[model samples]
Target: MSGIVFAIPGDIDAPTGGYGYDRRLLREWHEAGIEARHIALPGSFPFPTEADLATTERLLAATAPDDVLLVDGLAFGAFPEALAARFADRLVALVHHPLAMETGLKPEAADTLRRSERLALARARTIVASSPTTRATLETEFGVPASEIVVAAPGCDPAPRASGSRGGAPLRLLAVGSLIPRKGYGDLVEAAAAIADRAWTLTIAGSPDHAPETAAQLRSVIARDGLADRIVLAGAVGPDKLAQLYDEADLFVMPSLYEGYGMVLTEALARGLPIVTTLSGAGAEALPDAAALKVPPGDAAALAKALARLIDAPAERRQRADAAWAAAGDLPRWSETARIVAEACLRDRASARNAARGFREKPMQDQRAREQD
Candidate 1:
């Protein structure tokens, strides 16, 4: 059998979460014996100019009907309605969440993007969401029928062995995600402030993508709370550096208000770090039991309490981290995700052919009735 082709318009050169997910899926597709090729669309998407649209048009025109086009949610936002109408029957959209509707977007922009997202979902033959949370949002907020949507949870790479000094010194806390309001970085800073008396250091890694004002706000908070020395802002570390941080840290916290899927949580669990996160994001699902410390979104007090409890009790932290690590091992690999996609594509194609044949037969039967009349 001919192999299936998967196309995505994302920055293949970048090492961000979305980029990593796409790369893993491609690797899995190849492992599953499906021929997959990824096309990196221009980095400027979701607000692509006319020239960018022309480039994308050329790329889409080059794709054959037999190929399975997997459009990334980021680029799919700007995907013209004409383009969607043209390929509605053959395309599958991989939504990581409604990017344009993120809290980071300006109010006007968010509204426009929300509309675009709904239209895209309506036109897509298959819509694959990375989390059940996001799937529910698509159905409730965007009006995507449950029958057309499938939940394909993101997979994690194998967890790294925990390597660090098992000491009585201050615990190290890590939070990873872009520095943005939606990520609840401000709340994290406040949590850090509340627990400054404890012998702990908080390291935040990731550049700000939205709410540039929040950076100044965080600086002010750090100064006022006298936590400038203890709270370190380590911006945009590479995977190797992140792995090192994970190994050195005792706990991981991501207090985001929302996420399509929290890949960072999976990475933290793989490194055997106990997690503290909010229930609003997709990563909340990653913690099946008490393995993670859960808190309400935007509640600095609750987050502070959760962090303090983990810091004060070394035994509990280690116990939870071990359980989290064990659970992480069971997460599906990229190869499994690829296999599912391929199977779904094959089934959809077969169903389409059957429907077409039935349609053709219907017209013939109608003509015979007219002749009898």
Candidate 2:
């Protein structure tokens, strides 16, 4: 068992969902006695500098030939076709989401990513998608064969139900995600402002460093709407703090434009918090309808209406929370996710070995037949 070499860009411990998934996957693989190692590539992925590209080539080329190379799509999707082709026989691509579908990209950049990712994915021996929706997109949009993709959704850890607010306290709304344009935090602020007449406060727990301009815009919106006191931006919270936020929250809201898989939705459901989320990307199907008041992404009015419904009728919120709590038992575990990837790696290595063995044996067989003749 030569094991797997997981190549990922940037800090593996970053608070975002993709980084969190990678960290937990590696941890679970190690716990399961699978020989898995991490290789940190340059953080400027999906758009690496020439020097960085050379460095990436050197780092990946250094891995043992027998080792399975599992590359995260953040960098893998952007690799030159020549680079991707080099490891085609042993490469496994972990695509969180296609880079081109990210919100706020210019048309030219999007097209470039789409072309590059299609080429890169075609060279992978196996492709691991974070959700079924992502798998479908890759198959239909990227022209990947259905057999090459595997869906390994993120797992959830069970937690105690939230205590919520006291009788006299305002409703506590919590939203967790990174402050990137794709998250649609600006729309969240707009919706929050729409329901200012109600007694509620929103706390958004996410790192603002990913997109400082988006963070600045959100701040401007908050000040412009005079919601400085009602909305709190708790940036980059630790796990303990996030758990506390979940515990104290009466409702969870996510207005993401898209998600490869909505890991935070599972986190909120694990805590039995009623949700108000948009139906965008995989997040739309992450939870059953009863668990959240769903709305179209970027529609502030509809989002505001849904928020008001849950706020005005606490019993409905309680009902939704009950549904979320019931569903938590069925959510996938981290161990399961790790198991799927490990199996994929082993299967790929076996296939490669067999192909090589057959190639070697074919010539010998031919030579023996000729001698017999």
Candidate 3:
């Protein structure tokens, strides 16, 4: 293979799960001696401006002919079919989740994305999904063949066991993710309000920049429900601060409407923190029953009930925490994720070469047949 060019649309170092996964994969490949490099595309993805799209096209077109271009789905799924076709043979789509499945899209916009993603995914040499939920969605909903997709779940880094609050002063609940509608921050705030009788403080550590309106709305609701004192939106934090936050957390909560794979859940497990999460997309299977209390997505009442259950019972929380720690050992590592993606890239390269060889030989074989005739 000439090289593997990882094309990502926004800041690769962004604290979001998708970017974190992409960053880790590239880092692992570099450490493992695999020849790979990053190509920064326009940040306005999933809805790029015309100028950004043109710039993206130029950046992609500059890749070496034989380089396997693994494009992140945020931009790839929104590319016009004509542009997608230009690099179809070398393109590999890295789909965290279908863009159309995002929580707050208008029907027409969803339809457009669904159609565009279907076309883009179909054209790519291979599709790499972050979870089986995503892979199945591509196969059934997006009309991509199962054989063309690879599921490379995000890896969890090992961490020290969180020293949860002792003697039960108050529960320390932590929810991490960008303040986007799809993360269900509103639902989480509502749920937290319902359980105000419980002695607990919730800290949501994520970027507010991803959705300023959602962040504002969350703040309004937190104040409206008289939870302003109990809830803290810590915005984004660096890795050290995040790790420290994780260390002090008593419980990990994720109320996302959907996740291709909940990397934070595994991170919680790595630190032996009990979990409360929604059964949305991969979140349903991201953690074992013993490690989490799961309720349906968007169900604030059910979420509040689950939160209460874990809050009132310290023994139960410890049991779940222990289970989480036990499960952590089985979580995929960054190295393994990199290995699977590297294998996929290599396989696509080989397949492309074989297809090109067949294309070259076909005309010669036809000419020979004509001469014999």
The prediction achieving the highest TM-score against the true structure is 2
Each prediction's total of clashing residue pairs, residues at least 3 apart in sequence or on different chains, is 0, 0, 0
* Per-residue lDDT of candidate 2, residues 1-373 (tens digit): 5678999999888998999999988887665567779999999998899999899989989998888899999999998899999888889999999999998889999999999999999999999999999999999999999999988888776577889998899999999998999999888899989889999999999999988999999999999999999999999999999989999999999898888888899899888889998887675676889989899988888889999999999889999999998887676777667767777776555643533332343334434443453
Candidate 1 lDDT score relative to the true structure: 0.75
Ranked candidates, highest TM-score first: 2, 3, 1
- Tell me the deviation in Å of residue 62 in model 2: 1.0
Kindly list the per-residue Cα lDDT of model 3 for residues 148-181, writing each as its tens digit: 9998888777677899776846889999999999
Models 1 onward score TM values of 0.86, 0.92, 0.92
Model 3 weakest lDDT span, ten residues long = 354-363
lDDT of 1 by residue, 1-373 (tens): 3334455565574656677778877775554445568886876778777898788878877877666677888888667788777878777888888876576677888877887777877888888887888888888998989998877787666645667546775678888877777788888988888888899888898865434687778778888889888888887788888888888888899998878888888788877788899877677865766689898888999999999999889899889888887776565555445555555554455643432332344334434443453
lDDT of 1 at 253: 93
Model 2 clash pairs are: none
Off by over 4 Å in 3: 347-373
TM-score, candidate 1, is: 0.86
